[model samples]
Target: MICKAKAQWIGYPPGSDTSKAWRTGDVVIGGAAPQNAKLTVTGNIVQTSNNNYFNTARLYMQSPGAIPANGQTYATFAGNTFWNNDSAKWQIANSDLTHFGMMRFSATGINFYTQTAATSAQWLTETDLASMLALTMQRGGNVGIGVPVSQAKLHVGGNGSPIDTIAQLSANMVIQASTGGRTTDRGAQLEFVLPSYSNGTNFWGQGRIITVAGDNIHGNAVGKMIIGTRRKFNKLGTGSDWYYGDDIVIDGKGNIGIGTLTPSKKFTMAYSGTQLNSTTPITSEMVVQASTATRSVDTGVALEFVLPANTDGTNLYGHARIFAQAANNTNGNAAGKLVLGTRRKYDKIGAGSLWYYGDDITIDETGNVGIGTLKPTGKLAVNGILLAKQVKVSQSAANWPDYVFTPGYQLPSLDSVAQYISENKHLPEMPDAKEVETNGQDVGKVQQLMLKKMEEMTLYMIDMQKRIDRLENENRELKAKSNNQH
Candidate 1:
């Protein structure tokens, strides 16, 4: 029951102001058909609109009932309410009559609908409706850019995405000091600044992760990253006066250093003690440990030291390694060993990842040390012949050969020793030739046997001297008696 209001002006009287020229019709506020616009009478205003450029509807809600959640606390909160009209679109205009925002989706004017996803898993990396987000800005709470809910102070979520274009893929944050010159601060940084307790105006940085350009050579410029953690210091005039001792620096050469400005190697750590003495403990500590009680080859820890090799621009040749691994790979039984390895002679890091090495030394679980071997049988085992300047063998007083001179000790007669040697072809209480060939002789016990034999030989020599003296005296007396008789 709606129609376009077309009342013809009959005529103005000569002296009167105006006159009403109304035919049989109901007053329509919009164009021809208002039902197609989905017009409804909500309040005092006769809201009428049709799909046309000029026809429009405006709702002015000035009471508390208009808000979606009148008691919209955090606990029992219903979300946003959309004021949707089924006509062409919505265009909220100022007094100047310009559209405030753009409309997306199937709508034409300003709409509350959007296409941006709230998570990085959706791969919605594009920036449509990025500026004006339909966010609840009622309280200054945690904000999440691409997450379902804010779990942190600032939660930025996005993972590996295809980066085919410059601004198309990947969720990234850029902090730029674009207007400044290429000084020490080439780019911007994220700093943890703490307010000073002295006054609210003063602030100091507890830590900062900053980026800098190595040079201003445009195309050939290198970049370095610096992560600084300030040490505890007394409050001074300004932050420039504070001393920060620890900084992790990653240079353009891909070298990293902790507590050192210059990193000469791939990774370096430094600790500068004020004054070091004999009692100073080993510093610049690094520990590699297995997380669980189970120990195996897969769960072992190793520190490899390697140098770059002459290969296809990217190869490292292992020089040496210090590792701790399971001594035996048995399932139920477990033991640990510390192994040191040197690079095998044939490997040059040519093609395959060569992890095999020569086990130069090992300290096993039974306190046995092996050199040039893995399994040591004794307290100290060496696969090769050991070369040394001198060797000292120590024994208890009970083992010393001075017992040969004791009163109760019996010395073997020479005739008996000769008889035994003729029968056995070896000394008594000594190993045979076959035994010596199979199992090596103990140097300490052999030395003791040699000393005992030498002492027995000395005693035999002394007894023979006494016998010669008696025979010489008897011969001299007989010669004197024969001469006197003549």
Candidate 2:
């Protein structure tokens, strides 16, 4: 019914006052108030509709609060429950019903949906909502994004991507001052604060700081990165400073420095540690270990240093690799062989790689060392000539030449020695040139043989001296007899 009341109009059932009405089919009021007018309702209103009803609004609740200000309107359902008695779904739609959203309430949970197309819609539950985007404070009060079990105060799940989890980005990932201001000391920084304890002793801690910046100190603009450490206290009177004047530095050219910032090589490490003050002193500070227990065919470990192939704009020069490898070659019957050598890529495009002459130094499983070869048959084998300052050969007492001076020793006569040398062109007990050419001479045995020859020559000289003494005495007596006859 339409109401055109000047002040107010009260309606009621028949034979009943407006305050107490009992007979009611529906009490509907419809009116259009002028501008700046208010229509207030203090009772409840329910709109019932049929199932699958489309393009209908069950309620158009609006509230335009105070004038001369931007206002908001919302519907409030206070102290009321919505129970869908049947399985009939209640949906809210636009006037044409082409795009709509739905909400369903059941004993299990509430489901919210949004139509994706004309006939398809995506539904979401509480678990789906949590997985889609998470903003959680865990049991330990750690806040996180996309991480339910946070391990830090502010954790972000990395999602197994290349970029960092939490990144501050612009053209690049940067933490800088605001564009509106010019601040000389504005840069990204990560600080570590250590805990303090009350005790008679003081404790110092160490931390690392890394920085990346553009540098043009060498007249070329390039990126320079440095990693340094800070110590809270040290031997220099308990004051903190950057350690070792920048512990590590990497330049645009890819040169790295450990202790010296001005690195001369591709990788340089300078040691400035304490000097030795004990009986056992350290001569070297660096060690590279390549260890393995079980070795098979084509399986080994090595410490290799490789140099890239050098080129002069067009043609390739060479590449060098130096490695110390411990290998067990089942095919070659070599087990536990240690080889230290260098290989070079100096062949032509179609040829194979090459190694410099006399470059390999190998020690076999039996401790026999070989130079310029992989397999060694003796204690020391060298394929090339060897130069040394001096050589010493040790012999046992039984193998020495002192037995040549004994009384029972047999000495060959000069005529026998001459006949043997004339026929064989060598000594009786010594090797010939052809034999020496094939098998190298044994230094200790050769020295002993030479000593025996010297001792036999001394015996021959003593026998000749005795015969000369008798001839001289007879000549003196014959001269005395001739003088007495005269």
Candidate 3:
């Protein structure tokens, strides 16, 4: 509801007389010049006859020889209907009308009816007539019937038409309508309507439309599709964000992401105790070798057949291949398992053709052991103890025998050696019989005395022999000296 007007009035086109017209009403008042335009009414100006023709009521024009300039023209009055019935009537043609018919106060309560007198009259608002004649006046506009209604809607036609309903406006227009007024049409209604497209021009409005058409439908819309330029995030809508394809989301920073950040997807290192990992593939011929430190499975650890218990039978068979190399530097370490296809008596057991060399024997931390086909060179040290086993010495290519006792062979038991001596009525084979003989008298006193005496006599005999040798050497030296003197 904004209206603007310049205060000062200016002259119109020259020679096009700026004179005004008159109006007919209760008490006709006129002006002083041709441009005089002031009309007022104190009573109703009504029809004196039942005549529907536009009535005419002549009001006196401006007085002659009066300069209409510098006159503040206006009209003011009020009254009820003034009528004239009978043949004798008073009618004046109201042409060259000017000035709005002003009514005021108690006399302004004027109504027009039943005119058998005044034939023609024109009652127009001041601005209303000014709008029709294109006059330079303030706040004047034409009047018309609004759509779907018959109320006189005043409008500045051709210049400023009256804007009443919301349907008459376009986009980006500001409209103020009555909040709850009941009219056939009130608020704005935006719709897309077009007939069949006959040309490229028909598809476009004021500019070219940039859109993505899929499945014969307008699906995605972009802002400006500049030709030959790469497509960016060139579209915007009601919201600040944009939607990508399904599941891919764009955030405020325009960074498109697929998955969450916390507790991210990653690979992990796994550990095992006595067995392989649960996710490891367990095969039929495969085995996992466990290690205490590092929790690793060495290739050396494997399965072997445990000897069955069935009395003292010497025949058994468990044949398999050894696949791992023996431990390096360390003397007794199990490389892998060994399989004996058959067994024999203890005496009959000899070296076989097959051999797996290491320190050639395996002794575990607990002194449990296995000797491969190749015999070890010296005594096997197991858990800080020396293991005594028979050694086979090759005399020739075809002559090799198992071990026989020597000077330092510790008997398995003293009773076993005693039994051997008692049964044979002789000592077991000894490499040093004199050394054993020297030990005969160490158990009892009689033997100890005899041993003492014998030891003394042996010592004396050794000293006597040494003296004899010395005398002979001395005599030889004397004989040589005598010969030299002779």
Candidate 4:
């Protein structure tokens, strides 16, 4: 079955049709003739795959009820009944938006309701749409890539889920810096910029994050990240514009470098792009690496913590330090020593010099520790006062004073003891004042000698007691004979 009809309507020159006269059956269809044959009506056509007729069940736009004071006509959206629907009341008004000093247009702006409003009176009318909308290449707007609505300045949603987690694929952006050919690629740098005051059109980068190929080889692209900031100076620019300098770096080896690109340890804080093995030093460096070669005795690493005299950062004194150095300058047999030192500050009357600094504790290579002295002669040495609740001294049986109670032990007579003390001006077997002063007294040795003296005093007291007892017995015998004679 084939049916064909050709119809054309054309108005005369300078003629128009403004008539709203009733026109319903102007285009009608009947029977099977209208089923297969295609009747095309000229309008803004939305393409349908099957090329079918559109059902006119939905209502068209309502007439404008009244003109507002702004001389704008508003109409309710067609077929809007449900709340939170894809419906918006539209109007045409004079454009008054002014931004960037370019051409301004206002009739193209749109608005919608996001909240639940049951009726027309419950709707909150928005008089401005520029603040809510994220325009493309326009001011007062945010840009969203692959996002239905964006809340940030720039929201990018990438396609083809780069990760296995489906829920997390909602807001994610991945950047890949690759060279199409077999060439070394400098990794991508993302810069945060701000409009410069010198020129509104130009922008200056304030900070940047750069990702680099960890291995310089073409195919092997281990990732290294650098986060940098722009300071007052630039690459030969006179403080007008600035470039980025690396402030922190994380290499592919999982080493974090705070001030240097190459970190030797798991976490390294080098100063001014240089490590501790370098001779040249920067003035503003907080961490220092001294000279490596030609290093002499007492030369190694020293981390000093200094305290300022006042809030002005002047008269700084080295308050404390963790210092390690080679005690002996010999090549292979260099004795390493770790020293803990504290600087003591003294308040002067008028003008006194000298901030005091001395080693509070030291540990040497031979495992000898010195409390107040750097050079320790024993396993434990203290040059200051030692306080303890109890002390134990171990001595051999021959050295102990318990030998005094033995029968074979020689106990000096009282006459001999008196003579010996009068001659020596000090106790026998005890160190004199001069010797004790010159060489510090050993606690264990002194305690042993004192015990020996105490034991000797006990023996002399026993001998005197025996002599008194003999005298008493002789007197008693004499008195008994006298009484018998009387």
Candidate 5:
């Protein structure tokens, strides 16, 4: 156990005869010579000066001169005025010196345990040294000035039993586990029971003291907490897609946020204070949006919207939504094929002639085919249904054979006289290659009488003869007939 001395026998400059002091093979105070000394102890010593008065304080370790190579020094000291002058004191050689404590320059009387013979060395192992330190701290009791805990208790067994030993624990006492824990009838058990609260006032180790139900505080305060500068909240990497100071407020089931907290919401460019203000909503808005600038939408292939060269594995392989423009086989052997399947015999679009066993080429309702829009110019080559309308091969092949019209096809711009002349003029069998006959019928009245005689003449010869004679006489005879008939 530690031996404590206050040295309260005040004297002029604190003087006393060193001969009155105690000496041991392990410890030495002011020694047998006359010096300023009093109340010396050879064993573990706990000494404290009162009112900051200490003079000619000295301590020395007189271990053997020879120390083992690579040997360690174990020591501990702590005090406001603690100092040491051991810079040039250690002698290193081939002997062991372990477990030295308190080599401060200010504190005097180093306490130690050593071999009685000066030639022999005494050293404590780690466990022994630790035990001695515990014992010393336990015997020292409470210095009891400013330490948080003034006293502690060491219990061996049951509570409040007279047989159970209770030792007063010092304020600075650090009691270590003797052998870690204890073994009982119920295997190895570690039982820790906290001291009961002496008064109605609560203590932290038992019940809760002051709990922070909501926020403890807001804004920045010194030492209150600054989630260290090295620590980051949103750890978005060094890409351009990261945003900071954007807050996300979530409800019990929903979320109303300044910046979009949910993936289906929008984000606003505006910010309120350090927080982002909720204005616009972003459903599919991506921070790093990827799109196909060439086409209006993204096609999941590596190819651009327009390609310079066909990207076939070896030959010409088109990817998704593959399109061919003016693509044809040079030899016309139909070796050019668009594949849309794995390596197996399958239909691409369609095959030749009638009984083609292949996929059907479909025209969508919007008139688009394959993967894009289809626009026909001049004529559209259709493979599906065709609606038909009647067309005349020759307009001169009339309502009846006797009703011969001159110009084969009637033009839309033909006037009344022109239409009559065209209808009455005897058209040549090949009007396309021959001149049309426009003579002898009254061109003006021909529009009226043309239909009347068109039904009257049943014989082809009579019709031809009458028209030819009328043409031979020209309009001079035609006008007389018109007037007489009228």
Candidate 6:
């Protein structure tokens, strides 16, 4: 029944007892006037019905103008609230004016109740709210999924646990900026701004911003991306300051850098340390492997080098590759060959068109290394002149020229040596000038032959000295005999 004016009723209606105050009808206590009527209920407004429609009571506030800001000016409930009793308990205060628009449910103990939205079975029920309340009480702080928990802020998971905690999605998860037209502005980014502390004083810390768009992961910063520490002064009165360097960085073009921010290649590393002093050989720093069997196809692990074009720009610099071939035996007879060379086009000697150059250095299955040739004839074959500071050739006893000084060695006569030199234009057992001009001298063999000639010439000089001594004695005796005859 609608009560439009002031009405005071002290007693219960008809057959209703004090336990059942007013039975069976919708009750409206206020009038249509703006703020004229007031309704005060000394007892609890209870609803006890099995019917689904009218089994609930709602305190609906309707205002023509602005509602009062003070919650007490509106409806208030003051009682010991019980939910499915003994399961949860809380106290409500109508006089709590500071918290104006909020519903206060101060738990009587560790137990509390909360209501969720209506469903098909019930208007309101304790869905997961009870569990949520338990978690809040247990954690003693706010709960978050993707941030850190602070004194007042309830940030979600701080250590990457949120990803695992979230339900798996069937499709890709795209966090785009807008749902509209495709543009360069569409991307996802995560930023971190941490606070730094020194001696209990807080300072502005470094910030790192990571963005993902298309196929790139970009790292950015407003100022320097790295921060260093300052240490106390030492005995020399010099304060030690650590160098600021990039810990890790990757550009949009898939270039990765370690200890450097600007990487010019696919992967670049910059580091400073003392050279290893150990006598043992060290292992390789990096290794690239291709395990696929692509003998029929042209595929392998290649370390490619591409340099910029020249100033004229008429011809771009060609690529050079050091590659370990797969099973392909196209260039050589064997498979799995190791090749190092450029791919620059060169005019074939007796061919029609230009062809790509072959390997500058190649190693065959037999462990023979070749330079400037794919097929090697020996253990090491160089197609060009080899310049070296020194060359030591191992010689056997019979191969060495030390036999020239042996006791039974046969030395040619000086006259015969001179006759051979006059006829051949060279020393005995030595190549002539024409032969030397045609073929380059073998350094080791040439030195041995020269040493032999010098040893033979020493024997000739000794024989000449003995003949001169005998002639001098003969001359002295002849002079003495001539003096006696006189």
Q: Candidate 4, residue 71: CA error in Å?
A: 40
Writing each residue's lDDT as its tens digit, candidate 3 over 230-286 gives 122223313443222112222223333332111122311122233433533443233
RMSD values, in order shown: 14.2, 14.5, 36.0, 19.8, 24.7, 17.4
Compared with the true structure, the alpha-carbon lDDT of candidate 6 equals 0.51
| lDDT by candidate, in order shown | 0.60, 0.55, 0.33, 0.60, 0.31, 0.51
Which segments of candidate 6 are over 4 A away from where they belong? 1-255, 258-267, 270-285, 291-299, 309-317, 326-337, 347-355, 363-368, 385-403, 406-486
How does model 5 fare in lDDT? 0.31
Poorest 10 consecutive residues of model 1 by lDDT? 72-81
lDDT of 5 by residue, 1-486 (tens): 123234333222236533243322232354543222233333465545444466544454333333212343322122121111332222222223322332112132122222223453444333333233221122334322222223543312112334433444332323333423331111211223344467744422321111011222343111110111111235342445322322333322333444432323332332323324534433333232335333321121222222223346354322223222212323422212221212213333543443212212323223343321133221222334546695233323334333334435332222553575587664222232122232222322443345434433333455578988888889778788899998
Decide which is better by lDDT, 4 or 5.
4
lDDT per residue for candidate 1 within 368-398, as digits (tens), equals: 9999877887777887899999999998899
Worst 10 residues of 2 by lDDT: 78-87
| Candidate order, TM-score descending | 1, 2, 4, 6, 5, 3
Q: Candidate 5 — worst ten consecutive residues by lDDT sum?
A: 222-231
Q: What 10-residue stretch in candidate 6 is worst by lDDT?
A: 80-89
Give, for candidate 4, the lowest lDDT window spanning 10 residues.
96-105
- For model 3 the local lDDT of residue 25 reads 22
Residue pairs of candidate 5 with colliding backbone atoms: 67-93, 67-95, 68-95, 83-104, 83-105, 84-105, 265-282, 266-281, 266-282, 312-317
Pairs with steric clashes in candidate 1:
none
Point out the higher-scoring one by lDDT: 2 or 6.
Answer: 2
**Which pairs clash inside model 4?**
none
